[model samples]
Target: MKASKSIVRRTRWPDSAGAPLVTPLQPSVVYASSSPDALDAQYDGTAPGYTYAREGHPNADVLARKIDALEGAEAGLVTGSGMAAVTAVLYGLPGQGDHVLAGNQLYGRSMRMLREELPRMGIATDMADPTDAAAMAAALRPETRLILLEVVSNPTLRVSDIAGIAALARERGILLAVDNTFTTPRGLRPFDHDADIVIHSVTKLLAGHSDATLGYVAARDPEHRKRLYETAVTLGLTPSPFDCWLAERGLQSFELRYDRAEANARALADALADTPGVRRVLYPTRPDHPDHDRAVSLLGDRGGPMVCFEIDGGRAAANALVEAAPDIAFAPTLGDIGTTLSHPASSSHRGLAPETRAALGMTEGVFRVSLGIEDADLLISEFRAAIAAATAG
Candidate 1:
């Protein structure tokens, strides 16, 4: 019965009848009812049926079931975008006067939502350094109902203390919601460490392609799952059936894609360490990384697909990489099929003021790379040459 978890996630769903090895996409908006009473029961949650596309679509439902299996969750829900999934959880879990404690370094949009939208709705919000458990604990309040963090933060790739944070949440009766985007189930399942909720941007490594914009929420608590589903419906955040199908198809190759890319990223991180024109290389797998031991403990032997580094000279050298390297690409998003470079200062962290970003360790020269399945040697050669040319006078 023991096999690779990836194989289990892929094979858990039975093949559609008359269609071998493929899942049929159901794009219907409404389903015919056998009787009026049956429809009423379904509407009342006393029967099994889907009434509307916005409420529930077959393709999305199937994908959600698959996600539930993958994340070992009590339930899973899909949304149109990563932020939609996150926002649904935030909105559903908190009441008008509830409190939320979040990590200071999060995706720019996520940070903005907590700081702006939550307060507008009369919810109290607090931010703390995720790497410091004491700081997170100190920031908690009696009214704190939820604690949000990204396991591997945006751009900078700082690994949070998941077990520590989860423990704190348990002791305080607060729900710990972890964004498992950078580190998927393959990298590490946050729920295994007692995370109450796990959020993933399926548009990234789970889909393994840049085409689909999707996200998923996996909750360990059944009540939380029901609340999330209701909130998603109320907000009209359900994904289209077509996008759900594409994301479902993308999941088949995810394990293979994630492992290859993660290995290449670790290789690149190793090769770039202490290279000429390199000031700092931040990858949790590296022995010298501040969170290396924690990552190893939490993630086992797995690593993420992204690596972050800073080259010499300030913004000029960072810009030179784009100007001098024609082969490399500069994309704001991570976890694509191709190796792409991104500058966090101007992209992910631009929402923050200059001083605020620096205080979070996202410097002007910082660049992150989401490594693809390309040959590690070829990428090393290309980046080595580009780094030298960019830093040259």
Candidate 2:
């Protein structure tokens, strides 16, 4: 039996004639070498090679290319963080006098950037309910450059009408960018439904582990790709090579992990729905959910591995439940092999103002469960025990 190929490799250098020259090469040489003139020329966009880590790296390019293929995008760019990808996309095309129509319910940090940072840059923004097609249409202005939305509202688990929003944006001659982090390309490819751009927090599902922090921006057209690449280069938001390698390694088994995690999540959601002291179960797969029909039409039968629910005892009860869970870890992050429980009011949605948080239904009792690869029965039993302990106390 043959061993699997390692993700990392060491390359031999080429001579002045661009041929692999066999000189007394050392085993420590892990990268190819080029002349100063060749390096400068290669780093420039005119050439098709990488010359620096910040501008580009072989591993990062490989990962980005794979993501591009997965998303069916013309090009893709990687960034240090999710917010960096958002910033590069938002700032790349829109100018000072431009306007943007954004979904009212967004990831807290993204909402902050749109409401706080863009305004300071002289870019005007209007928030609209993503589910209401008329409301989204009404928010568009003559100067609106883009419409940004999330496939699934973070923390709240609210699904957005991507096709409707995309239609509205198209009619108004505005670009549509969808944050597909929660509904990754494996489950839901937004580009197929009229989205012009797709952004992802690779830290989550793509990496499938909590080890690396990375983001990606995939564009469907050359112009959009050029703009995003230019902005990424200028902003210096490139991801590290090691992180990119880890992401690539994770992508190899993404399909299997995603399927298993999603199955476990559905089982957990059903169990939670029947548990006492639970106010409401928020899962995209539920037939009675607000956007259930849309989700089905867009994502088909498979829902991603995230579930949000409200506890009967509010913040104190929620905290107690988290503390009582001996197996599941209480953490602010998500998308790992082990289950993670988080409090939105102080974690993912902490950046939102009180009024905004209220509007988005991010109450203290709201808890987000990132289902992992653990056995479905074990996870349910653990949660049942935690709820029992919390309520009894």
Choose the strongest candidate by lDDT.
1
| Alpha carbon RMSD to native, model 2 | 6.7
List model 1 lDDT by residue over 17-57, tens digit each: 56546777777777777799999999998998798888888
The runs of at least 3 residues in candidate 1 whose Cα sits more than 4 Å from the true structure, single-residue gaps closed, are 1-20
TM-score of 2: 0.90
Q: Distance from true position, residue 286, model 2, in Å? A: 0.8
Model 1: which ten-residue window has the lowest total lDDT? 7-16
Model 2: residues with Cα > 4 Å off, grouped in runs:
1-40, 43-46
| TM values, all candidates | 0.93, 0.90
lDDT of 2: 0.84
- Candidate 2, clashing residue pairs? none
Question: Across residues 73-128, which tens digit of lDDT does each residue of candidate 2 receive?
Answer: 86699898888899998999799999988888877889888988999999999999
**Candidate 1 versus the native: TM-score?**
0.93
